[model samples]
Target chain A: MTIPLRTPDGRWRLWPGLALIAALAAGAAAASGALGRYELNVLTTMLCYLVLAQAWNILAGYGGLISLGVSAFAGGGAYCVALLASHTGAGLPLTLGAAPLLGALAALALSVPLLRLRGDYFTIGTLAAALALQAWVYNWDFAGGSVGLSVPIARSPDLAQTYLLACGAATLAVGAAYWTAYSTFGMRLRAVRDNEEAAAGLGVPTVRYRLAAFVLCGALSGLAGGLIAYQQIAFEPGGMLGPGWSINALLMCVVGGVGTVAGPVVGTLVVYYLLTTLLAGYDAVSLVVEGLLLVLIVRFAPQGIWPLATRYAGTLLVRMRRTA
Target chain B: MSAAVVLNGILLGGLYGMSAMGLSLVFGVLRLVNMAHGAMLVLGAYLAVLITAGTPLPLPVAGACAVLLAGGLGYVLQRHLLTAMLVRGANGPLVATFGLSLIASGLVALRFGSDPVSIPTALGTAGWSLWGLDVRAAYAVSFALAGVVAVALHLTLSRTRLGAAVRAAAADPRTADLIGIDVRTLYALVFAVASALAALAGLLVGVAFSVSPQSGTSYLLIAMAVVVLGGIGNVLGTFAGAILLGVVQTLAAAQFGGGYRDLVVYILFFVVLAVLPRGLFGRRLT
Candidate 1:
């Protein structure tokens, strides 16, 4: 018997989009050898956030669970290296390898209690928990307190290597998103998001799917955090676990195209470029603009700018050519 | 540990009740979370602080003006920005409010800097005794005011014709609209009232404790707990939730430590939400 390997909606057509990102990453790697120190750092940080946005997309966009507490998982990922350095003096590769696993464990712990809260309560619950954990981390000496943990300099990756590592993670993240867009697992997540009751009635194992998504997202976020730790060399709790990181991910995922494979990637690049150019060195102005931009996008383009552009781009281009 | 702590807890809860009231009311009527509610409350406190600090206005007078201005601001927001958002869907409004909060906090930070700015009033520090319990003058006043506002709101919801229209809309907006009750206007009025309540709570919180530009998020967290605990949309239940939370917090603080209060409160909040999400007195949300 023949088996179907695609979602009924022909989501596989976007596989080319995945290949395009792969090609771009290859191009970015080849060009990174000649880039300056500042450009290297900026690009690496942007790629880390790109991974975060893609991770957030899987949870909120596909699984229909919104969380602003992803920093907790990211923090878990970062601390893997920190803890190892403080206690065991593990090298960069080993510490980085442990991040996704630690992050998934942290997410699993968070989800058991978090998932029990229904509907909108999850939003506030996760936020409160994250903040509480942050505060607790400030007091706990074992976790390096609020001063935060440092990666041992001897084991740190160089700028060029860090950029390539970030590129690797970004590729994995985008691949995950692309897989979700076309795979049965992603279909179940989308189903649970659209209507939990109906999906449950259809024997979709909604909670399990949701838990799996949360864990996977958490692991991905952890990987991003680990990459940042390697890059920054010594990062603090405020820098890593602050609401700023979560807010950036939210802005990128929503504005780019929530639930679409290319949305978070597009959103990430667009927002990163905008922040660097338009609101550089102006924290207050950035907050104001980001907030306003987020509101406008939600109100004006609920499905997000990238999705709308994709829908209209072909027709608009054809019409322009005809007029010309 | 003592009656004094219990009294202090209840007094502190007064502000939380009103803070949650605004969020609960909007949720009841519109079925949407007001992510900007806390920012709106902070804005109210800022207005009160500005008038009290910069102008020659008395604390009470400044507070009153803040309340009225906030109510008017609520009307404008509901009628203009939110009305359009609400028509889109539930999630759209959430993101919209989230954005509103970001803008509000950013503006506050830009205008005043991130320093703590309290009402230049001595209401919280000034103390008095009644029935062998020590009470701050401001806390006493707020506790009494909470009583008055609670009774006023309850009576309005129960007895007034205007309130009846709001209730009808909350119960079933489509039916109320079909019955020619002007659901949109009712929603606008409800939002205004809720916003005013939030501002009043903000004013009280500023006096009883202290308010800063960034104080919005903590108050918002507590409000969510109160709303969740008492039930979403039930006014009296919100106060009940707030009172319980206050008692729990103070007790936790006394027994464990101040740092543990948030740990305890948030854990309890999560546990309650997990166990009985409808709240002790709230209706089924879904």
Candidate 2:
């Protein structure tokens, strides 16, 4: 129906927000072109991760599936594009389109079987799936095995356009995540997440909602994967399916507050800034720091920084009202 | 392919069973999946290596000493670090254990410099052949040690007061506390036993193969799979799951080479999760 965005309180105060987002995207794109190539590449990686992590939030944070294998799905999409690009005469656009579709297909296949698990079993099952997928890619000689396949360098001689394109993809993903999280279906998903048995009793079709979240999560992660493939211009199985991406997604969701529209964005920016500045060139140290961060947040700030901020904001509003 | 291979798988499964028992025990008692369990195993292995480096004591004695050390460390960790964080929620334990895992891995990396180390054992070049199948001395020793550990564990769990207290805590901490069981003491003892078991598994692995900082992850994953497959909160179930996993792994390795071995085991794990969400050995085993 091509409906415009509608927030939680269904007010017609959306045009300004859209305009602001559009301006911000434009500014980010322009800044990328003005910055150094390395910085631009880092920004691209961050944007791609933002999309992937936010998409995973749809399932893990909202629907409460907590899949730790998002990188596996992302890697699957990357390998698909790499293999297809090598064989066929497809362009970047075609690769981007097919990557998400293929990822969605994989999700559909895995979800039918995986959705049956309960509690931590589901999480572990998904992790096992990720590990197995990595193993498959590692040994599957046709996909270049563990060494991975390389993407040809961009011959277009235009860095600005590529930066803009990546930004656009990221913005599109954010919009998709926001829309899905705010829609009526999203409400049903929340109901399911809150109490699956109760939701099922209320005829919310809990399994269907979960499967939809899984599919959406898979597609968005695939888009991010395709973007990453283009940005790196290479695909490596070990690098793509590594636990770092999984940990990053978890960190983002936990820090930003899962089940919120702006949580992942905030989480990503915080984590990315910390990684780029504070913990640069120290992989083991960073991992320990990250692990500590996760433990602290889960223990002391389970509601996350955003949700806490929101609560304080609400309190401030109430104080102003009382004073008036 | 043959009885010997099945027997070997069964034997190896015994050790895997032992590896997973500690993790399962902790999870059952606390409902906290310790992400650092593998790190504990590595810590135990390294401790064994350091203690018996030039000592005339036999490898088993050194292994026992390592277990005691690991148990003591585990007691301290549970008393100090874990108790504070465990009250929040299930995810609290997961995250805390993750942090502990990082610390353990980093500390080991710092101390050991990522070098692979093996405990010196005197069972070199010895084997018993049955129907023309060669069984190595190391495998025999590993299997025997594993069996001893498993039997001892079974006896401890089934016949001892401490084991009864541990089981009570595992079943219901609140109820156990109401019945005058000191939960703090039970938790410490459970952790100590679990860590000791991890250390024992580490010693077996070290002498049978080799040990390094990076080796813990693979063992951790396998232990988790075993716990999940056998159903959580049950020691015998862990044993059964471990043996099943061992057979699956060895067969997969023999059939598809090392690359697909893990892949096949993981596929089975997923299948088990999908079909029997409660695990192959459900709560009934506990």
Candidate 3:
């Protein structure tokens, strides 16, 4: 059975969808001024996670490259902002501007080696790269060693501003995902993901397509990291470049739905609220619940909650129509 | 670098090899990268520590119990969880195991606290001089134990009916099943044996080096490096790869600083994976 894209009729709907998203994002940003500090903080954090989840979805869901080292890019971006701010006394705009570039550059360099690995090996390779980056940062005196570095408070964006930046980033991330969903590029990518050999045999540049997705995801992850740096102010390698980032991204993507454009958005909200907000002080319990959820999701709903819910809803609609 | 450091590295490699063997076995048979392998090792270590510290049991007895328990846990995990996941697709087992690792580590941390702990034994601190090179008693014992296990495992796989069945199953599950071989039972048995080996390695690691609940990831990375270097599913090659990794790490630490050791290993792992996906040993068990 050939499954069609969400909008397979034409690209005409893309313009309206883009405009609607822009309006919604602007509306959210404008409405954020009325939110208290706690609500703002939570929303900002969720937005950042939305960016991460979306970025991860682009790579793993569409690209078919299950990277376990997303922290490498996210941390790389945060470090870029931190170092730029500290060393050159760069403004927030400049620091944020450089973050995605740094992330993209790093992905480009690593892609040569990383993209060579296939399937499970690729996952292992990305994981090693992240840990290696962390270990290197721990020993490098230039990057403040294990003590970590702080973003210049004077140059940093305040909570409200950080939220705006995160909103913008999340919008871009979602836009990217939407584009990948309907565009010919995304179709080619899905083709590569579904069957590399067949795509290659059909003369698709599989490696190039995969690399493009990898780099694009890296850029988005880095932007999210930059926003995180602005929000946290003082961050360490352990917190920034830790496995937690990868875990969070993976959990959000898997739980929501893998490969679906709307999955990460739903996943980010569900996971952020269910695990982070509800179980704030209970670290162990949170982890246990998170793990159990992951296992259960993969076992029972491997296609993820988004797809499962939609499928069930479709069936229910069919039954109602038949009865009518 | 002193001769002693290299000697110590070789000794440490024995434990690394033993730890990696289980991971390799699972990957070789099930083609599933058990992301919980390191967690299983940590669990083994914690269980041994709990038994020895809370009870009057000797360290050896505690170690044996931990191994047995780990094996049983592996059996259940494979039979119930992983066996079902295997049919779904590739990502199912990987994600499930990742979740399992999280659960294992979280549970361990909740029970034991996050602080690093080790089993204090005379062997841990005692030393012996062999040809003017100092070797810790724990290292020596672990190395010897690893060698013995390797030899025994080799013999079992090569010289027994069970070994033949396992080999046949690994070659092709469907074909073996058609020929009256119970592939599911054999898989569980293989996973159990692998878990037992990992537990043995964990016990040695606990005695020789401290382990915390979060130590599973590092151990998992080390096991992955060794498995890749030794060639996946090649048991003997795993031992050799572990030794090479140990030597490389030790030398890198000596050349740079102690903090850079993991950095070097991870870099090496990435490079090797990119360059030699088949592994340095260039051997396939199946």
Candidate 4:
């Protein structure tokens, strides 16, 4: 019966925030029609990144699980859809529908072993699992081994349909984030994050809450993977399950203000825009710079890259107002 | 498996034990996983490779210098960078170390051109036949090196006053400080020791196997699995775990082929984590 607590200072602005997000998504969807195929594909990938980042934020920022295995879940989901589509002659609808659940199941099984660990142990364990999964996929015969599988739909999805799908998923992901950020469930999760022993003392089922967050986040990551496979139409398991995917998603989350509802969406836009626009031709060096940026950001602005940006923006706004 | 496989596995185990010691030591003393450990190991190998390529110095001397260089770098990193991060809390250190790993890997890639490089030491091309089993000279040398390092570290921890101070600081830093121990210096020393050990392993790996800039993740993963299997912070247990893992790895590779070896090890690790969360010989609850 408890409504979400949106602000630490106890304000109720969840609905308005969600409405703003909905409006932004609608505007973006409308804008997509005017974009060329190349630009549309770029936006679609960015949307996928936003969803993935949101999923990561939910687990690490809110649930206190610093998991390094996002790629595993995403790969699991991608493989499920790809396999179903290729082998059983399943349509895109059925394969995509089952994708997230399959990912959820894999994550649930993984969590049994993983959730038993905490702190750095958990991080290490997850990292091990991730690398192992990648290796497994590389060796698995049915998953196409190193060559990977191409998703063959009975009817190929057009660019517009794919764009819409990504937009819808991103919107849903952001909405889910907003709900979690303000919902009583999110509050309980935060309580567990801040002080698990105290939360347990107050009768919170910390384990269950954590498991729920893990599975939910896994499902989100998995769906993003599925969407990537679907959009690209052909993908290697390495691309989906590589350390790069996890690192990119992690960068986005940290850059955007982890645990904030709009952080992932905003962060995704800023990072991808810079990567695609400013550093488009400098891929190799940009990667090195991104890695360094991660270190500098963690050291200098542990709160996030966006939070620092917001501070400067606020100062500028104050100065402009004063001048006016 | 054949006797050759068993011998090679045992030899491999020695290397694992040697590397895992540094990782295990840091966990025992500082309670940080040292994510940059793998990068440090690769950097050590790269340093050895680069120095030997440019200089006429013997492999042994260059290796020693590499280890010392790694130790000094570790000391500086801990004192200068990680100290401030530690004050923010555990996550700060974790993220910061991860960042260091990222930077190390990127720098390695930029320098090494993403290509695999091996040490050109003569041992890599030499071997001996013991009874009916073939023994690679590099593996045998690495085994001997691991034995020497492990015994030295073990004796130091058990018999030395400095070791006593480290154990005391590890057990209770605040109390150790109350009792007049220099806790900060101890942390720096432990970090340096851990990094140096990683460098030693890196040198061994460079001689025996090939390494690339991208090898950091795999090395880190192996180090983690060893530490966990051996028991979180127990050095002796880490040795046992490394031996067990080395044997299992050889057996798995023999049974399932080469490509499947990592898969087998990882799945086994997950199974172990599930069934025995504390690890086989773990001293710490984590």
Judging by DockQ against the true structure, name the best candidate: 3
Winner by TM-score: 3
Indicate the DockQ of the complex predicted as candidate 1: 0.67
lDDT (10s digit) by residue, model 4, range B1-286: 3889888888888888887888888888887878889989999999997788789988889999999999999999888878677767677677677777877777777777788999887888898887868988888888888888877887787789998898898889889999999888888998999999999999999889988877877877788888878887677788778888888999889988999877766876888888988889857512
Clashing pairs in 2: none
lDDT of 2 by residue, B1-286 (tens): 4667776676678778878989988888877777788889988989888877768777678778889999999898787767666765455566567667766776777677777887766663467775677666666666676667667776787798877887888788889999999987778777888898998888878776777876676677788888878888777777888888887887767767777766766777667766776678786325
State each model's CA lDDT, in order.
0.83, 0.77, 0.88, 0.82
Per lDDT, the best of the predicted structures is 3
Candidate 3: clashing pairs of residues: none
| Candidate numbers sorted by lDDT from highest down | 3, 1, 4, 2
Q: After superposition, how far is residue A68 of candidate 2 from its true place, in Å?
A: 1.9
Candidate 3 lDDT by residue in tens digits, A1-324: 844324666444566667777898999899878999998898999999999999999999999888888899999999999999999999988889899988888889888767876678778777888898898898888998899989989888889988888889989999999888877899999999988899999989999999999999999999998889889888888888899899999999999998998898889889988987699888777778889999999988998999989999999999999999
Evaluate chain B of model 4: give its TM-score: 0.96
How many residue pairs of model 2 clash at the backbone?
Answer: 0
Against the true structure, what is each candidate's TM-score? 0.94, 0.88, 0.96, 0.94
Candidate 3's displacement at residue A208, Å, is 1.5
Better of 3 and 4 by TM-score: 3
Q: Is the docking of candidate 1 incorrect, acceptable, medium or high quality?
A: medium
TM-score of 2: 0.88
Q: What ranking emerges by TM-score with the best candidate at the front?
A: 3, 4, 1, 2
